[model samples]
Target: MLFQILLTLSIRFFLFDFVLFKSLRNHLKTKGYFFRKLLSCPFCQGFWSGLGVFLATHLIAYNLSFLLPMLSFGFVTAYLSMMTTAIFYPLIDKFEKNYSTL
Candidate 1:
């Protein structure tokens, strides 16, 4: 379990950290108007939003697993990963809007 958790976190960090940073940097350069008006910092805001989405998805998966015996933890983890990626789209938009203004 520890190994799995570590592996999952490593993957998440590796995939997201640079992507998020770059995204913020790009948004700051290209879309300054939106971000400043929204009162959000792309790097900081994106990190927290991503973290929140990850945590919420995992919590939901874990809670549901209790009622669904056939749902393995691995399945939940995989689903969460996919879901996390999908959730990033809207966050990117928000980040762009928030950071561009600043």
Candidate 2:
């Protein structure tokens, strides 16, 4: 049980902090809005984004797993990371703009 929880948390943390966030940073940099902002808070935004992605992916994965029992952890992790990043990109962009002015 503890292992499962830890694994879940680790996956969420890594995906959010590394994959999703790095992608956001790169995209923002490309857009010329690479300012550090306290708007909405990065950690807070990351936590909420991670939690939302975790829940949504779990539900989707559960349903899909029922149909195909070999979905694999890697696929789920990547999918969740991509989904969360896509969802939060716009919000982060807005925050980046806010941060630049300050």
For model 1, give the RMSD to the true fold: 12.9
Instruction: Write the residue-wise lDDT of candidate 1 on 33-84 in tens digits.
Output: 7654322333333344444444545544556544353244445555555555
Residue 42 displacement in candidate 1 (angstroms): 21
* Model 1: lDDT of residue 71: 40
Candidate 2 lDDT, tens digit per residue, 1-102?
234334554555554344346766555545543233312234443444444444545545556644342233334444554555577778867876788566
Best by lDDT: 1
| Candidate 1 to truth, TM | 0.30
lDDT of 1: 0.50
Residue 23 lDDT in candidate 2: 63
